[model samples]
Target: MSRFRKLSQSIWHCQYHIVWVPKYRYKVLQGAIAVEVENCIRAFSEQQKCEVIELNVQIDHVHLLVMVPPKVSISDYVGTLKGRTAIRVFNRFRKLKEKPYWGNRFWTRGYCVDTVGLDAEMIQKYVKYQQKKEQVAEQRDLFNR
Candidate 1:
């Protein structure tokens, strides 16, 4: 009975930290593209009926800290998020249609998802910091160049 209970608990109220990269690691998320990606992420969360506690969209990858309901599968959730956002972003950005950005899929085939325990605050801080860290890196790279 205890084992069954543990299994059931695992099925419910699970938190997932997912990361997916852009195809070929293209750094297309610049200027207005980042804002569009943000909006698309919000829309995806709402449409999928999932709770996105934290999300950070970098130039080549996205970090999402989300809670998955018992009925939803992690693979499906990631696929939907990536697919929908790609479509929306491609449609909005004309330049993306040419190459590197829209010539192929927006996201890579595989993603990283980690099951997390109860540490919502820490996860949120990490997600927020990822964005800041990426921005700083970009600035530093530009300065160095």
Candidate 2:
């Protein structure tokens, strides 16, 4: 049921469900902080050309289902998302500076990532059909010219 993205030479639908927690798993994400965290992730994902299919900000952790391009690195994306959001969150909530987190890191070192896949047969068939559709469209345009 997922949609595929077409590139010049590739078509892909790479998605992942990712989870991570705050340093020490503190229950600090609430109210303003929760909203800010969500906004920050959305903005960052847009800048990276990634799509956030779903997101949930809990008091101690976050769950994000994102659709990323095949060319992007999963580890790099998660790192950037966490690191940049941490800086922005800290800047907005200066009181958090008082927290005793080592090196002032917001999120923990490790995270969870799982791929989202549709039925293999369905994806193969869709891609196979898409190629033919594109070829027909190209031929039609040539005839119209």
Candidate 3:
């Protein structure tokens, strides 16, 4: 497809929608903190060879849509991204470490990830219809018995 990304040996198109929250889902991600966080994500993602397609830094959570190459694992990328960004943000704003529940951590333990591909709705509908057909077949078999 035209949207495929080329690698040294492969061509693929893999996009991910990731969501993560700060420690305690605090509203601290605003003003200066938000700006620093955005900078960290952008810079770190560039290092990891991930393209930031879209990013929304909410007060309590962050939503990101990114294109990550197949050579990199999504889990590892998210983990390192969180870690590096936390370090940068804390270094920039030393007072953040003194806040409640800081404990030298910026983000929560894990994140939510989903694949972004073609026609998810169509696939979902096809699965639902298949399930209905199976249910009907089972009912007919039970009646026949």
TM-score of each: 0.80, 0.78, 0.79
Q: Which candidate order results from sorting by lDDT in descending order?
A: 2, 3, 1
RMSD of 3: 12.0
What TM-score does candidate 1 reach?
A: 0.80
In order of TM-score, best first, we have 1, 3, 2
Worst 10-residue lDDT window for candidate 3 reads: 119-128
Against the reference, the lDDT scores of all candidates come to: 0.79, 0.83, 0.82
Model 1, 1-145: lDDT tens digits are 3211123456356778888888788888767887888788788777777778788888778889887776778888888888887888788886677875456588788999888776767877998898787778989999999
- Of candidates 3 and 1, the better by lDDT: 3
Q: Residue 71 CA error for candidate 2 (Å)?
A: 1.2
List candidate 1 segments past 4 Å from native: 1-11, 100-102, 135-145
Candidate 2 residue-wise lDDT, 5-47, digit = tens:
8878999999887889988998888899999999999999999
Specify the highest-lDDT model's number. Answer: 2
Task: For model 2, state the Cα shift of residue 98 in Å.
Answer: 1.5
| Number of the top TM-score candidate | 1
Off by over 4 Å in 2: 119-145
